[model samples]
Target: MKYRSESILLLACAALASACGGPDGDNSEAPSPEAAEQDAAGPASNDMPDTAPAETGEASGDHEEADDDHAHEAAEGGRLESHEHGHAMLAVTLQDSMLSVSFEAPLSSLGAPEDPQNAEDEARIEAMLEDFRNDETIISLQGDAGCEIVSTSTGTRLVSGHGEMQLDYDFDCENAGGLEGVRFGGFDQYPALLSIEAVFVSDTQQMATELSAASPELKIQ
Candidate 1:
């Protein structure tokens, strides 16, 4: 079941990438599918637990329906490089007992200047990054899952004079059988961020939704 989930995730991501491209493929210039897959599966290879239950009957049907809806959403407006101000892109996947997250956004969306010119500007950037590094300040997983952060990677870059940042996280959950949802905790912390285009892939479900400071939770079973 775990291996099957990985395969499904790869296919879903491929479709997402294709759908994210512009007419001339100019808008598809984001991370490669390979890199996305690595983020999805990286922590699983290490001693990550495998406790999620397999889906059957109506659960399987619901999963398929979710995937179809997600495809439609992607075709409409979700882009690989959703670089709009006050907006960000977030991806989450739960395979076995490992949960991985990939997040990207414009630095200005977090209330930081695009280009840091002095120590004050630099300090602001660092402060925002520190907030991002705190799981409690960024997102929340169910406590019963016994999840612990396994790894994290973050970086910043500039494109066309706009500063952008990416943050990736992996968690090892001792018991993920009933893990169901994650809630974003950054809304109040970074009020400048207005929305997040999010995707969630689990052992039996593929879901996508748009989130706002008003509503910031992604539920996956």
Candidate 2:
């Protein structure tokens, strides 16, 4: 069942890539109809814990049951939202209606298409800019590292952390795609850099007011 969910996520990513035109602009290059049919037959992975009764006298069994209960409680207590798009892991925690988005990746995991010193490597990097522009997932910017616009209207913002860190990103709600809408696996060729930028809009303005008032020293412009 776990494998089934993983496969579904993979297919979701493939569909996303295909929507933009398959690799080389050939629609025929997309996954075959038979593959999609097989995927549909796959069962969904159960996220909930098992309900079997525990053994009465075994300490180990009791401990296991307790752990499972704790896990179920944790899962129910919080929202664990995650999305993989453009080869990056995006997770968010929503507390009291406020949302915090975190983007992450392992730097060592990113591979260069060729030697970084090669001209072709530079060309590949350049070509990626086009992909970035086309990617509805990433927001574009014209500034250097440290600080930049989160969005043209929402205003610029500063980033935390330092040294060999991922570039901070300000996602545009209107233009940027939602976390759930992103396609997975298509970003395998890009570098792994993680950075985050956040915006708060809600019925209660207190959260945004406090966040704005407690603004960090980092500049966004």
Candidate 3:
């Protein structure tokens, strides 16, 4: 009778262990072979490397439409070019507290600069940039508004294809609310810059002024 009871107890314990088994008696679930194989065959992910951004000389402001569709070829005020090298184009636009001034000029008009292939030619360009950087007179704004140049973007290079050179200048101004006038001092620095066709637009007025060596200042109302 004692042997019989011991055998019964052992059988009951085996039955309880089998009933409590939760798929291999472990808490973690095992992955199916099909799911594992699919994960193994998943697509490879390649990380892209960082690259330098392309240069674009876009300024913030509304582009003034050409006064005439054929204005480019037409000369105004007896000048040889209505839109060509010997002259520079200046545009100043104001929106809210932000002020921006954009300047464009022909490379040849800077002087008889040689093609910038050698060190000496490069130095000449560098000198001009230094002058512009130091000149507070280049674009004088009404001082009452406390306007100041915060950032300047300028680029100059020779183009072999058209034998044309270009200089682009963009200045971001802070505290430009009281801006009332501007004076282009390029003529004072580069004698070749005879005149600047300027378009000034602000909250109160839209004006077109031609600044020259003779009359280099525009007073904004």
- Per-model TM values vs. the true structure: 0.63, 0.25, 0.54
- Root mean square deviation (Cα) for candidate 1: 15.5
- lDDT at residue 175 of model 3 (Cα atoms): 52
Whose lDDT is greatest here? 1
lDDT of 3 at 103: 60
Q: Could you tell me the TM-score of candidate 2?
A: 0.25
Residue-level lDDT tens digits of model 3 in 1-221: 00121222222222233322356554344343223322333344110000000112332221111244354323221111122556666656666665656565555556635356567866775566555545656656654665544545555533321112232333344556556676676676678767766766654445666788889876775
Clash totals in order? 0, 1, 0
**Stretch of 10 with least lDDT, candidate 1:** 55-64
Q: How would you order the candidates by lDDT, starting with the best? A: 1, 3, 2
**Whole-model lDDT, model 1:** 0.58
lDDT over C-alpha atoms for residue 129 of model 2:
33
Error of 3 at 122 (Å): 1.5
The RMSD of every model to the true structure, in order and in angstroms, is 15.5, 21.4, 31.2
Residue-level lDDT for 84 in candidate 2: 21
Q: Per-residue lDDT for 77 in model 2?
A: 22
